[model samples]
Target: MSDARAQAPETEIVDRNLTLEIARITERAAIAAAGWRGKGDEMRADQAAVEAMHDALTRIDFKGKVVIGEMRGSEKLGLDEEVGTGRGPDIDVAVDPLEGVTGCAKDLPDALSVLAFAERGGLLHVPDAYMEKIAIGPGYPEGIVDLDKSPRENIETLAKAKGVPITEIVACVLDRPRHASLLAELREIGVAVKLLPDGDIAAVIHAANSDDTGIDIYMGSGGAPEGVLAAVAMRCIGGQMQGRLILDTAAKREQAERIGIPDLKAKYSAEDMAHGDVLFAATGVTKGSLLNGVKILPRKIVTSSVVMRSWSKTTRWITAEHQR
Candidate 1:
């Protein structure tokens, strides 16, 4: 692991302050996400998360910008935001408020509020298009698996490389109607499938941190905002992931071009997607997947997050006490 404490002066100053700021924002989001736990309303849960993040960003002492954020007025909720339109460090912000609303509603595990911050033009502002994604834990060769291969083939290949059996490998997919066929296919291959109601960021992080979650792979199309945030975590954890935009229509294609994405089929690696030093923080909203959810008491709320720095390859587990 790189010594995050020993970076150059300029890098150190920016990274340290950014990490602290992200930690605070994520902590607030955790409390907000918890309020919607078991409410059975995903939208309200997500709104609460976004509101907390908005409040936190406004208070931070930085000239930040929202390169990617909750869609809100846009058709999509987490993509399609104008750059430099929101408050805070002239920096880009990517967030998934209440990443797994269904999980929170059902009290499932691994739901979190995920966010990534970078200097302007650092994070990819991918269009609200499907992305063919494949990822693995650290130390695997690049390009080992592409989206074109069969799910079984990819799983077996990854398992072989990791020296694990196919049966032992666990894959995560969004528990959606669109994934019905994909889920059935994995079942036939004897690979264990961990279907999540929401929160691909938690799934991706689980794949990246194999030791903690035992999720060997993450395959499926999820929110573009979550993908960008996962890219930041992958960079810090030395994992490998590739994503290609899946445009459903010409309007979406035009949006891609508007954001300077020349090739829709181009593959984005962790470094390619998160192009510079980044500060990432994710607070658990419910008791599932990666981290535990917030616990509210009479006088205070307890929140947890996994904050990471790409430049330093440092990941910190933070717990904060907030007054009610």
Candidate 2:
């Protein structure tokens, strides 16, 4: 009799292996970045994370390309930098080695090392800019919230969907002058707001896990690269997100056009940015909303991570102890 399990396709096995391997990639970056916590040198902490992540990536067994990454002018792991052992499935990699360098430097919260991978061309090739984003977690009416809707309207609609009052709905936004109007509008509607200094990716994921995070929605503009990473996480968490690029200048528009983005005002949904089977991994550099920061002990380092696969709808929280 033929063994049914043996007949499974090679790509399936590759994907499963890739999911586990990607977690380790984020883990290495997190551990390395944790070493520089509270050093008050954001550049040095970020560089450490980038170098550690790049080296770990090169050791993975696959043909991986950095489609979305740090700026090209960077000294290490810039855009289009190829990693891996130069073998296995071809994949597109989106990475943010240190999502909150300032937070890490000051020993604040919500710093992380994050990355997303998909089969070649599965991830969006978005140029680094700003993205006007709005997101909500799983289990709601289709289109309960939207990027085109007003802040007040989305809050009202979400409240109605969740059987709660508008004032009880909590929204998360970055604490910045640019979001002053956004915060004012949400507050006007009596929506509770949680403002963080940085880490939009973690904020979006929190909004997606409302039951655990107590954050019902996330809105406002953030980095385009981080937007893609958040989209991938939402895909795994069964959430919804919409983003429109904030290409305000000619140079930014030109950069988008050069990247084959003909539509300047193109709106990208979570799935649109990270379509098909995908894997998302993140490890906290500092205590955070979603995962705990790396805890360095005398004999070993403890790291917390989350690895998710959209195809399988699998999300794993890994607690690993590594000997120093």
Candidate 3:
């Protein structure tokens, strides 16, 4: 099939205007979360972001369906919710209104408001669960890293492919108890490991642009929705990523089935998760490795956002100053 037919019935669904509109959506969520920064209340901060994002989404000129969203039952953007104005082509949307609630509450780095857009049935219907992910930046061999490979073996292969020593490669992993063994293994292999408090989406995106972000690889399990979001960005940037959902409970397995996932042990590649002309947008809610934090002044709010399109291979950095 041709690229256009594989992606959508109409080629104009994800034009530049729609890309910028998605950035605005993320910007609103970032500004709202920025207000709640350092308040030590994660719930309130997340609520602010969700409300702001949903409001912004409702104004967009498209028919959007939320395939992946908040896992918690109380969040505003629920799974399967229909957003957007009733005046545009039908599309799929996956969102994380507030990706790092803990980071926002504690004023830590790497909190972000993120979302991805694709034509209907273009994005994987990933259920809310833990996902094991490993990613690398662009320009590497297609199978340089694999989820089935041990961390030591993956790093050794990546270092050889990059023409760098094992000691020079920097791996990014989430700072959680579950990663204790993973971190230790990386360190034992003489690979430098950077631990992040929250936000694996930023970590993986950093890995996608190691020259700028200083992250050569990202490994560990995080929210499955964020994994899908990261896959979207990786697709736009010409990177590699693989993920496998951990359906440890019967309920989780049942949930995956409801979302149309047939195989409980299925592994996902970047293209498998988000295929054919994807648009991804993210705004930094706090100071982070990938993006700058939102700046609020007396009368204006400044936000840094990155918008990407896979078909055009276009990555645009936008700084918008909004008058309050």
The TM-score of candidate 2 is 0.95
Mind sharing the TM-score for model 1?
0.90
lDDT of 1 by residue, 1-324 (tens): 346556644553274477877888877877887887887887777778787777777676665666677754423334434433344446777877667777877777877887788877789878766677788888788777777788888988898998878889899888889888888989888989988877777778889888888888999888776788889888888888988888889998998999899887788888888987788888887776577788899998888888898767889998777888
Clashes of 1: 12
Model 2 RMSD in Å is 2.9
lDDT of 1 at 131: 75
Candidate 2, residue 186: the lDDT equals 89
- Each candidate's number of clashing pairs is 12, 0, 0
lDDT of each: 0.78, 0.89, 0.90
Cα error of candidate 3 at position 163, Å: 1.1
List per-candidate RMSD values in Å. 3.0, 2.9, 2.6
Q: Model 3: runs farther than 4 Å from truth?
A: 1-10
Question: What is the TM-score of each predicted model, taking all chains together?
Answer: 0.90, 0.95, 0.95
Q: Residues 257-294, candidate 2: write the lDDT tens digits.
A: 99998789988999889997788999999998788999
Candidate number with the higher lDDT (1 or 2): 2
> Candidate 3 on 1-324: residue-level lDDT in tens?
677647764355555368888999999999999999999999989988889999998988888899887765555678889999877888899989899999999999999999899988889887778999999998888898999999989999999999999999999999999999998899998998889999988998889899997889999999888989999999999889999999999999998998789888988999999997789999999988778999999999999999998877789999899998
